[model samples]
Target: MIRIGKSVIVLVLLLLAARPHVYAQATDVVALTPTDDLLTALRIESSLSVFIDSLHHRTVRDIQVMPFSPVGRAVPNAGYTSEQARANPIWLRFRVQNATNKPIPLFVRVNFWCFESLQLFVTQTPEKTSAQTGSEALIRLLPPRVSRAVSTTAVDSLPGLLAASPVVGWRTPVAARPVHNRHFFFPVTVPAGADYTVYLRTLKVRGAQVVPVSLLRQAAYETWMQRDYLFWGGVLMTLLFVSLMSFFFFITTRDPIYWTYLLCVICLIGFMVINNGFLNQFAPSVQFWLPRQNCYFLFPLLLFYSNLVFVRTFLPLKKTPLRWLHRLSAGVLLAGLFCVLMLVVENWVQLSSPVEMAFLRLFTLFYWLPMPVMAAYVVMSLYRRYYRSAAWLYLVAITPFYILNFGQVVANFGLIPTYRPLVNFDIYAATGLFEVLALTFGLAYRYKLMRDNSDRLLSSQREQERTTFATEVQTLAQKNSLLEERERIARDLHDNVGAQLAFMITSLLHIGRQVEQQPIVNGKIQAEQLRTIVGYARDAIRTLRETIWAIQQERFTLAEFEERLNQYVNRYVQQTNGLDVVVEVEGDSGQPLTSAQVLNLFRIVQEALSNVVQHARATEATVRLQTQPNGTFCLTIQDNGQGLNFSPDDADNGERHYGISNMKRRTEELGASFRIYANAGTVVEARREAEMAN
Candidate 1:
């Protein structure tokens, strides 16, 4: 028993899937009154009266006489498509009772205008219970029944092809519609206090999307159109703004992401404009017809393709499932383009029929169905990383459209039944506007971050260049200072070696002449002259050694300077005939001095000692080193000899006080001071103060 019940349930489920989903299929008479200004056919019982000519090639007269199943399915109120979707055309017929004091003029409107033909047929007079007579209206009364054997060839021999009211719809140009709108409106006037029947004829009428029909007063129809246009127009403006803004950014930064984003929006706008029926109403017929006829899927296919490119460029899709989605979208794009090429060639070759074209257009949705499922993974993956705030905003902006798009895809594939509210393109339009506008803000933020990073890199490069320039300047300055110091050392060598050698050679020559003339002088005379020459040679060697040492070092500490000074003075005292010198250092501050400072300071001490021996005629000399406050070094050389007087006039005298001037000049070279004054003995003091620290 259980197995039988399960099998029966399975059979029932298969039957339901195989059947056409339709609802509210019965048509009834609608009563009209003066108080009713506007109404939609969706909610009323009788407004849904429609008949399908299963064989699409039928005349208006044949349809009027054929039995219209009073049970007719309305567009939105009905579930979805029925057995008569693309292959057959439908005729809509409804009865309305005019209960007003005057004849009621009603407009029967079909809200889409893509049909190849639309004709209006109505009874000329209101029927009273089974019969009524009035010869006033333009149309004749329709018969209750049509003969199946009525010959179409016999009817063509008559006066008109229609054999009914004048045809109007796309057969009449869009500009010549009764209301001249995006929708088809046919006027129906019912005489007061009577009933009349109306019919709207359509051929090749199905659209890519569902179409809505409404019945309203003339004023109400115009007002309703204004509101609809206003809403869609605002959406257009928002999308246009996004396109312009992204294009401007692409120009400024030349980022391919922005360029792709602009392309996506442009394609979206084009697709939506055509899909919304705005282009059908406003565009020139020849210019507009070719695209829908040939490359109908171009804009929408390009839209999804560009969107995939934008996602790949702006986000890291590598090593993920979304990468496959990108590839699939690419395939769809190429297929759609190829399909367009084939359509363009249809003028020469009958590659496919209109029915096949419709099927192919809808079948492309199979490629896009997996996109929403994959998008869920991408959104959740991106959400976990709050750092990618830009991509997150992009996903947030498109989330609504993704939901609607999922519904659209499922409906197109017949996996779910379509309803006007769920499957209409108008909802897509609103969400599309929201997506582009929000993505614009995200693009701006992303650009700002890129620009800031660029600026920081540029600033760091400039700072590095400045530092390099400063280092180069410092190196050049040091080279110049070294060259100057080498030149000073050469001059010192000249003074010690060249001048002393010349004087020694002259004195030796005179001693040799004296020895030669005397011939029998004591051994003491020859020996004394030889010893004098040796003393001069030793002094030259000592001076040469000090210059060499100072030149080798770049810097000298105070302790090293003091120790070297002491060694030199001891050697000098031994060379001088029995001259006694005492060296005393009072301070031991570990101060650093430049090589030039020590060299020049040591030379000043040497000059002062020479004066003590040569000019002061002193037997004993004292060399004292003292550290003054604030990093100053004071060197004093005093002798207990008859004091010598200092005179500026003597300094200028030719070579009279050359040693005095040399000491002063050397002290000045150290950027210090030199003083010569008599205390109980003659004192020569040179003071050097340290420079301020940076």
Candidate 2:
């Protein structure tokens, strides 16, 4: 479970780290909006020859003009005709322009007779002038030349008279004065019975600037809106991701750092969104209170908080001055928060203007500057600890953000010419990318730590294996030495005891034969000689039996077990002259038992027979070995003679003898059972339990 959690955290970190470079490679544009105002304006100016210059100084040509209002048809007098003539009808024209060399399309607005306070012209009418008799009002036209003109007897009537009813006129000035260094009006008036001349000429202008001023304003508004969406959207996503990661890490690892970092990320994301004007859209009422001027400070404070958390987690400088640095960062961020609170409470009146806002923002930048420096310090510290790769990753992650954020800082202070463009390219969007990169670096460092730990664990495991192997080897060597010593002792016992016992037996046999051949002076002396020989023979037999039993028990095998039992029975027959001992064996002869079990069973059988020989004193004895149906081998020694008068208490009280006790103990040692009783005579039974099937 521990391993699984680490893997998940590492995976999430890796994904976050790789997200920035992957997204950057795909595309830079966040959104695009299309507008037709410029096109509509250009189409209206088709008849005019105008040149427009764009911001890049490119020229556009062949501007045309179209009427804003079409000329109305002449109508019969509906009221006092002469009074109607005093009023003038109004008409408007629009111009279309092709400002680019390659014939770009344009739309323009051209106000007609705008300077005249008389009624606007509603129609175009043809009428002969009294001075020219048959000649009508000429419609003058100009060629590409500035002064060239042509005439058409197109219109010469009062603009008001041309329409059915007279129109009212304003007693105000014919032209509006330009405001804010922009000429916002175009005015033209045609007199009654006069040739109306329209001149067209090309001007040196950039085609791109041919876009109407209104359209430019609209574009900027849309761009600002898009930036708002992207900035806040990114901040929200980052907050959510950080929150989720925090919860995950906390739950999985029970780590406090992840939760702290999550809190810091949320605060930082909030600060950034508010500082960037993103929050303004959603909470427009707060805009009046939010100090736009303090954005500079807010942004750096956010960075300070975010980077401080990152450094504390990544480097864990918990002791000494390094720890104090984290505390200092937090203090700075708190100071920034206090500044924000002051600004909010002051209703933004304290900042007063963009300049004041910019100054405060610059001040905030200074506060945040320490975070990156501290990050660098952390990276350097890690490098010194042989975490060079992790340090490099940290450096790479932070560098882009540092440079871009610094650019923003500069732009905020009005050090840059254009604010929005620089902010778009350098700060707002770039910060998101940088954050993702930094997260990736963090993941990489974690992975390196995991790899190093795994390597260490593997090394430790290998060392443990080596130690275990050496211990096992030493144990085996000790066991081998013990076995050798036991074998030497067994050989010595067999050689010394067996040889001495055999020699004594031979001398006793010879002495018995010599005594039998010798003449006896008295019956008592011969009797004494006979008793001495018998005693010598009994002592030798006992010694030989003890030696054989001891030797056989030490290294008894399956075959030796059967042979020893047969020898014991034969010896009993020879010793008890009137007693008959019969032995029978059954079951698979090829079947084998382990040496320990065989030795145990052999000792059990020897003890049982010894008990019968010493205590039963029966006339006949029968020993039967048989395999039972339960897969166990059973041995029964029975004597048909005078039943022993011993009680069961004798066996329990250690009064009966050691022989029965030894039999019981040996059988138990082999995980078998021993049974002894005196039914008709003495009966001792030992059974060897079979090995369990695998």
Candidate 3:
């Protein structure tokens, strides 16, 4: 059946080609007649033939001939002669005939030249021959053997030939009239021997035999042409708008997708302009330079590049077979660019054949093949990645453009002839609109990602800060614990050890008093021992008081501390007999010491005093407290009589008492130095470093 249909179409096309002059018979003819018999005698006979061709691919059918003749001809005495016959007025009559089996209601259109002075008079039937005296003709419709004249009156008349120009005469709407089934006629007159031609063109349908079919087809084609121009113009304008926007966006944003889109739109508009003959109408020079071959090459390259950019942005085909496809597209584009450059250099003018042109267009179809696969990949990837509704929306946005563009391609390649009219529809317009919408959606998606990421980062930062703050609080708590422990230890030592020593001192004094009046042999030795023991007790009490003071707060100045120390030492000296003690104060004694350092100094002094009274039975003891220029305090206790000949072995063998060891330990704990040596006498000295004021 397909083969039969194909063969029938081929035969019809051949038949159409065989009859080129068939359209010439459908024009309206005009004849001129004279009013006077003298001018009629000079009348010459002439005939005119005109040809009309259908622009679209169609065969003209059911030819209608409309002829009109003039009412009167020029008279010699009426300021017109034989020389005016060339410019004389003419009128014509119309006739319709049907050669097919079906009846046809004819619509006769009389179009006359403005300068020919032609006029139309429609009657029921036209007369067969010219009448010498009348201004009317008989018209009739005859079926095979029967013919009848309807009237002999004129419907309208003109004075002279119309000015030499095109003119529109009588036109009738396509109305349903009697189906003649055979033939019909109406007639008018024209100037004798005047040369004139008429043009007859079919309306719309190709090879439509029925009159109604032809008329309806003609009206439809006209309407279609009008709509086609409007739709195509609107699409071209829209493409131009998007192209400008894309260009501007590319300029501002420097995004490759915008540039690719701009180029695509430009190519799309070029294809539209060239295909619709707008390029031929407005820029015919450029049209000569461009043809179907160029369109084919340009369209595919633009499409491929645009797809690549979109895929890179929307789909991110950075790996796998998709990546290979992108590379292949790039290679094809480069080859196309090279071809364009060669064409420019070599001035290659036109495509060799329609097949080559078709091949070039076929490349566009090939270019489109990757898009569906790419879109599917994108959809799958985005779905797996959970990109909300963006993936789906993007696919929807892209689908229409894909379909329209590919549909246009199919139409251009004649894959579907019915879709040929849609070839000029702005697929690019639809495509561009969709692309812009898709880009907007993509930006929204990016914005969502950015916002989510920002939120996460802020949450993480808050968590980290909370951890840091908690760590700091823990460290502070630990430090407070250590400080409280130190205070407790200081308080315990002051209360316990200090009370015991005070009680012992009281007991010793009471014993001394009791034994004073007896005058026993060892009474003096006993008194001295009691006194030394009492001195040791006093020193212990002073040391405990200083420790409590150290723990309470900070210490007083060096001058005040020294004065208090001197008074204590003097009281000790007065109580003990057989001892001379001298106290000396030097330098600026007003320098301050820390509470801990003061406590260490007091203990060291107490240890030295005990040592003096217990071990040194010498006659004189000197105590000195001095402040030095180097921000330090020095305390010294020296004995002038009977310096001990202490051996290194004796000190090492534990001969040296714990008083000296304790003093050294206390001084060292306070960040001071303690030394024992003979400096003109046995000297015990402790030195403490002080903080310098800023």
Candidate 4:
């Protein structure tokens, strides 16, 4: 199938390169009716015989004698179908008669840029007689013309001519004026009462050999040129303005779509100007220097690349669930690769030798592949409702180009005859204008969507923050209420129980004094007992006061607890003059202590000290509070005296046993380990992890 397709493509190219298929086209013969001004006539041959002429370097005089087909007669509003012409030198035979009484100077204008060389030949008597028999004389139209033209390369160079730069006063006074016109002009003066046959011939290395001919007198031709210039100039200016505005938008917003859009517009403008033959006039340097394939492929390639990129940015495929967008991007890339490949092959064939089969096959593939891929993407976009409004607008914008270019491509495949309107009018430009405009609006719409999404996200974030703040405020209020309640409880305990304890301690001291004054033996013993009770009552009041202080503070730090413990120990030692007490604190004592931890720790210390003073009969006792680096809090109380003779299992009656049991119970309540043993005197130790204290 592939081989068959290749053969078919080659045959089609051959047919197009050979000549228009000689078939009878019933075209009306219109006379060039002259007026005072130049006469406008579209008397062109419908069917033209193509002869491959290689006398490219020959002058007009030499080409005049060259044989050309004698069959063409100019008919009004007639054109050779675009498919029937190929990119090669071809001579078109057509006749134009001066149908007026006076002599008229006729001008011919060929309007397209594919023709690299064009010349005119006019004769009163054609080589053939009848129009019907002239069709039979289409063979052997030309033999290769070999001519030696004089060369001027041997001229001697002057001193200044060979210099790298021109001398200050040596340059010629030549004014540089840029030409602004399209269409190759040829003039012929025909005598009245004459039928002049004209042969129009041209050569090219690329593009279709389409010749759009029009006959005009001098005044009318000038008027046409003026009008054409004005129209194209206005169009170019509008595109330039659009490009500037797009650039401005790009600069201000830093949006890549605007930059791409501006470039696409500029390329579109250049495509119009170049393909319409305006570049030959405006930029002769580019026309002469740039390769034909480069010029031909540039604008279309840029159009496809920029347009696809813009569309991708406008409606990103990654954001959608649709899978075909990947295929679309791949298709676009493939199309571009094929286009470059085809151009390379064409340029290689021109520079070296013709490989007609590969050239036609690759060219056909390049031209035909992009259309379906683009069409599929557009259809899918519409069906999926992707960028729905923009999709519809894009559909409407590209419709004309698709319709026109499809016909042209089909004609190239020899599937249908070439459509005349596609050759004469540029529907691509018309559709492209709308496409760019729609895309501009689409870019704006896309920006709006992004902004809306950003705004919504910002709003949601702010609302979440507000909710978090409100929750935090409520939590703080609850904490404050709890703190106030704790303070009130501490105050109540201080006012009632503390006052009653103070009164009991005072009354006991008074009773001790009164009993001492009695002076009887039993009375002295009673007074001593009263004094001991008073000492016990005073210790109880101090403990109560410490408990109250711990309760009042929201947080009791270990440092503050240690300070209170030292004061209590000092008070106990001071109450007994015979005993000396030592309090040593080690490590960090600034760790925070909870209320339960503070109360239990204080009670344990008080019990240990009271046991030392009342039962140990020791002269000196030491209290050590140490905090380890691993957050271990240890309390140790040791006395230098005769130790208690109590077993660890004795939990029944002795004061020593009761004291040990009470300290052990307090240590257990604090989640600490408790141990008591005699080492020199007696030592009581409690250990707890600081975090567990909380």
Candidate 5:
């Protein structure tokens, strides 16, 4: 009686479990039906769970299961709240039952794009606990077949294409795959019968992991892929266009800011390519880096640090009170450099992988924390400095990133509803575009400001030069008037005083001869005194003539001065009665002499000549003036004379030093060197170079 009870109980339990499967088959809880020339599939509600296998046994029956809630937050849109689960290897269970008139051969398309090591299982009906084989057994059952490529036309007749079981595999390595239309397709045979359960196991998953599981007809999946590719192609085209334009501006403007901005934009583009799964699509090997979070560390480091430098270059912080901001920006740049080194060591140096990864992750977090703060500070400082337009540009540039990162942060923590379309799009690229445009305009404005400042400075300098020129002209006119007065006095002395002295000397000579003829003693002494007076008058007349000649001219060129020296020497030699004089002018000085220089040079030559004629008592004299190759003017006066008959004591007592003193003083005033020696004769030499224009 006990055995009969056990059998009846078993039959009742089987019937009870079978009832729901029958109802599910009739009501279509999760089945993909072909309609509108596309595959329409619905997921079974609340059938997801995490597979926890604590025991050493790896069999499917030994696996422990927990309920899987993909989204744990309260969703007002869905009118429900679900409990969150920790990141773990998850399992999804779903059933497909065909309630149509014919057998449906449809493939299951699971967008396990963001998952790793996913395994799909199909059975007529899942038992409470069943011993299972490994994934190879399933691979063997659904072997790859030579299936025809799917076309859009085939989607309308999906029922006909669903005859054979579909092959299940991966386009890239399972580890690095992220959801970007990289769906896993599993072909199934769902005839008009009981339901079949499908199992998806994802291992070692992390975060608010989303598994976009769906079922699709093969033709419909292909059509969807074409559309997806087209959309991404458009995005790529836009990025390329913007990048090219940035470089073009950089080339034209020659600004480092534009180049840095361009690099930041390109890095952003690269990041989107990696994040959106396009890089993995092309090179599946990149999946290895995803496990290490290199995608998070590398590209963002480039973009963020490049932006920092770009901001520094854009702002006028170097000479401003807010220059400290530039230093902080530099510190951020150094930190970024350190992060780059850490990433390189982690990825390529083959170090202790865990430690390297930890360093990279920590640095990445720290780096981003200061970035927005720095940007905000830059904007506020610019505004404070009255760079309002630049501040507006900065605000525009950073707004999109602010929205994106903030929204992503809140959504990841389940603080807000995750808006997939907004979060998934490359908002950084959009922000980068705006920033590049705004900065380009700002740079243009800066250039204009520089140009205006330069023009103003030039005008001020020209005005200053004009004022100086006017002052110099007035001073020169006053100097010329003073010189004219001196010339007038010299002419009066030469014409009147000079003639009177000559006439007095002649009258004294005549009276002396007449007194000598009469022979009276007192008269003889008086006549002797008169003859001495006549001699003194003739000496005075010679001195007066020289003074008059010197004060006559306003200027004397080197050639004219040499001519005057020759004429004076010839006249003095004639008066000396047998003194032979040689005057030679040699070489040409292309530069002209100023009035002061000419006066000083002429006076120096005059003193040398007077000393030779009056005191040297030389029978032969030569005055040679020449210009050296280096523009030095040299004058030498030599005479075969009773050379300076004076001792060192005589010079110290200021005896016979008048002419030497005058020559030295004039030479010093002209910035020339003077030398005198009593060798063959009292030789005097003066050397000078032309002065440069003021």
Candidate 6:
């Protein structure tokens, strides 16, 4: 292989040295070898075609005799140095020979889309000089007297329903470019052993001026097109799926972020549809008359605005000092809106030289630079926050998108020189696919975050409700207790104090009557009655004082209960002469009791002491209080006296039974057990268990 390469280079050098002009021109020619004997399909670099400067709109007759240079490689920089050169058509020249015994069909393809026109002319070289090789052979190649021309049209026009719709941005008309595909293809047939030179003139209205052409056999062209169709079909279907899926999410979630992302995806989808020529192939009348050039500009601007809105919706920036970023984003959105208006004007004005007008359009269009700048700023800001929030998803998802586009932009602006034959690579497909998929994941993550937050909020509300319910129950219980206490107080004041006062009033009236009857009365009965009246008044006053004290107290512990019991017993023993009482408290526990419990228990103790003092007829009595560890308690009162045996449920046994009944009722009301042992000495015991706490 090395020796062959060396020999070929030496032969080319010798040929160039012997006949520089002929060999150089001959290098551009494509030889048609027999297809069967060929070991592999040949790869022809489209850049090898001869380039002729045809700025003046030259006809085929005029172009055939034109001179060309080998250095005029990539047509984009093929001396587009002046307005006149930019205005003219690009002319590509190729020479092909059919070495097979039969006529062979050859296809010349321009792989780029949206060029306005292409024309191919085939002129046969004289057979007499076909085998000649030198300046003489090269000279004979010019001034073709017989020729055939092929047009850019690939299909014929149809009437009525099959006609292209009259709209704003449809592709080159079906009549103008009968080929329904994006790329231009021209087919030509060369006779056996015949040599011919072909010229292709392509006219582009705007954008890049690169003209790339390929030569292919009939089988190769069909196979290439079949593969191309399958790839494009799959791409379009996938984009459609993404667009529909995004739209569905926006509809169901009603989320502004989803809506924003949907708009972005829609723009990208539209850009792909128009740029790939599907709009030219498959719509009603197969038309795509929209402002194709401006749409290319408009879609990117819309995408930028949507992306900004998407970021803003998810970030918690409103309360921060960086809230100014919101206004900055709005400014970028406004710039996008303004660029849209510029595009609208371009479409409406439809200028002759759109490339010149598009220069300013492009300048204003990139004012959206702030959109990506804002994205970078937000990413850094969120990173500085240590990725604590869901905003990090946006950064992770779109990073690859910007990275890929940045490289595309650099290459698009020609920051790096084109060093070899340029191949068309679909950067749009790569970046757009990655971006949408990553963004979809980001949105899903955000949704999960939202659901979690909602769950926490609901749980908090439920806990608050439980607390409020417990408080309400406690309050109701307190109110009920207060009403019950008021009723008890009413009964005590009426039954005890009122009855004592009545008896005192009666006694005084009787004494006064006896005194009136006797004139100067000093009777023993009268003196005793007066003394009895005074005792009744004193007893009533003491009863009122004790009732007031109990009512004023809110709560009591077991220790306080013991103290109060001791005081009551001491006072009672003083009032009743010849009576001895001892109060004993064991285990001075701080066990808490409700106000109602304390009042009832204290009153029970008072009733027991009164029974001993008035009825027991004994000199000694004892009150004992004890508390257990299980939040339960016991209290006992007993005396050394003549014990009377009776049951509280038995028929009423006069005034004596009333006090006993009261003590039993009070103990039962407090959820405690009461027992009286009628033996040598009376014993009353009360036991209470723990109450459930709120």
Report the number of the highest-lDDT candidate. Answer: 1
lDDT tens readout by residue for model 4, 1-694 = 3343346345545534543333354433335565434545554555343344554444323444566442244211222212212334556555556678887776666666554455455544444323422221111122222112112231112110100111110011111111123555666666676665565655544444455566667657767767667766766777787888788777866878778778778877877877776665556556534344356555666566655665565445646676567566766667777666655554445533345444544555554555555555666776787766655655555555555566555544444445455555444555556566656666666667766877898899999899889989978976875675465445434543555576676777777676667755656666676666666576556656766776676577767877887777666565554578778878766677766567667767777777887888888888888877565778988999888554545644575466577677667766788887789898888888766656
Cα miss at 305, model 5 (Å)? 2.7
Q: Where does candidate 2 stray beyond 4 Å?
A: 1-235, 288-300, 319-365, 410-421, 425-427, 430-434, 437-606, 612-670, 675-685, 691-694
How are the candidates ranked when ordered by TM-score, highest leading?
Answer: 1, 6, 4, 5, 2, 3
lDDT of 3 at 442: 58
Q: Tell me the lDDT of candidate 3.
A: 0.46
RMSD of each: 9.1, 19.7, 23.5, 19.0, 19.5, 10.6
lDDT of 5 by residue, 256-362 (tens): 77677678668777766765566655665665664343553467567667767766766657667776766777777777888777655645555454554466356
Clashing pairs in 4: none
Q: Residue 12 error for model 6, in Å?
A: 42
TM-scores across all candidates? Answer: 0.70, 0.42, 0.35, 0.52, 0.47, 0.70
Select the stronger candidate by TM-score from 2 and 4.
4
TM-score of 4: 0.52
Candidate 5 TM-score over all chains jointly: 0.47
10 residues in a row with least lDDT, candidate 3:
205-214
Worst 10 residues of 4 by lDDT: 161-170
lDDT of 4 at 565: 75
Pairs with steric clashes in candidate 5:
105-162, 113-178, 113-179, 114-179, 166-187
Candidate 5 Cα outliers beyond 4 Å, as residue runs? 1-65, 70-88, 92-116, 122-198, 203-217, 283-296, 315-322, 347-357, 382-386, 426-694
Give per-residue CA lDDT, model 6, range 528-585, as digits (tens).
Answer: 7778888889889978777787788786777877787777666756455656878787
For candidate 2, lDDT tens digit of each residue in 1-694? 3343346445535433432111112111111123334322222222212222122121111111222222111110111101111222222222222222332211111111111121112123223212333333332222111221111222333221221111111112122221111112222333323322222211211000011111122223345446646665765686677667666666665556556656655666666555443443244344334443333234446556566666656665556446665567666656656655654554535534554445444544556556555555655565456444445555555554555455444433333322223334225445555665466447645645766887899899999999999988988976774474355335434443445456656766776676789865566855665576565567556545644554443344345556766776666544645557777777666555544455456555656665666666767788788764455877787888666654423555664455566566656655566677778787777766766321
Give model 1's clash tally: 3
